[model samples]
Target: MLQDHGFDVQMVGSRKAGLMHHEGWPGLRIDEIDKKARFSTPRLLPNVFTINAGSNDCLQSFKLDEAGVRLGNMLEYLWTASPDSTILLSTLIVSADKKTDLNVMRVNDQIRALAKQKAKDHKKLVFVDMNCEAGPDVRCLVDGVHPNDDGYEKMAKLWVNGMLEALRKGFLK
Candidate 1:
């Protein structure tokens, strides 16, 4: 999605595409950044970062507060790495059942609250609600976990929209 916008992209994600880069954890996820991995660092700091994670963490049974603290750690790392960069923190998408969906919402709420609180300190943190952007269309999803191409397009549009909003507010300046 970002590449489609003419950005030079270098994406490294878990096999399950969660935020964490840990290797010792047991699960179906593969480590994307084990030792000896090539092209580990970007040539330049990014102007913006749109993060969509926490679904995997939530599904993995991480408590909401624990997820928030871990996510906050990641956010602090990004801010320290690129102090001038704009960070767009997105809410997790919907899951299959109500129980899991509630957890997703709880995690997302924590994410949004964290972003809001951090924005007060670092002016570049912004929240983007992907769940609201995706709406209530089950057909857009593939199975109960992943999204279809159309769903991805929708996500891309929402990201672009959030970027535009940030630019308008001079948050990207």
Candidate 2:
């Protein structure tokens, strides 16, 4: 989507797609990402980061109260390791189950609060509300969990919007 907008893009990470390399791994939670992130030097960090974590944390009911703290810790580590980077943190996509949705809403609330605080402090973090913007349908879910292709397309657009928001706000250095 970014490239479609005429911006040069080169994704850098372990997961590879047609031409993008990303850090995402399926089924990983927020704490898990923190524990497994491996950018050991400033040279390895990218200028932009997009994080769509915490779904698994709410899904698995793991340290629900600390989701925000865990995300904050991860952001802090990333900031310290590479101060010249922009992070786009998104709320989880809307879920299918009411119970999971409750937890999803809970964690999303925390995410919003954290992002607001970070913005007030002038941190390089852009908060994307995927839950409302993406509009992933319960009927579009596969395996009673992940979203279908159309839903993913909606998410892709929101991601582009988030990056554009960052660019518009001059958050990228």
Clashing pairs in model 1, backbone N/Cα/C closer than 3 A:
none
Give the CA lDDT, 0 to 100, for residue 87 in model 2. Answer: 91
Q: What is the lDDT, from 0 to 100, of the residue 36 in candidate 2?
A: 63
Q: List where candidate 2 sits over 4 angstroms from the true fold.
A: 39-43
Tens digit per residue, CA lDDT, model 1, 26-89: 2221122212112221334556767676776667665656777777776666666666878788
Which segments of candidate 1 are over 4 A away from where they belong? 1-44, 133-136
My TM-score estimates for the predictions, one after another, are 0.73, 0.93
**lDDT (Cα atoms) of all candidates against the true structure:** 0.65, 0.84
Instruction: Compose the digit string of candidate 2's lDDT tens values, residues 67-92.
Output: 99999989988888778889999988
Number of the predicted model whose TM-score against the real structure is largest: 2
The root-mean-square deviation over C-alpha atoms between each candidate and the true structure, in angstroms, is 5.9, 1.6
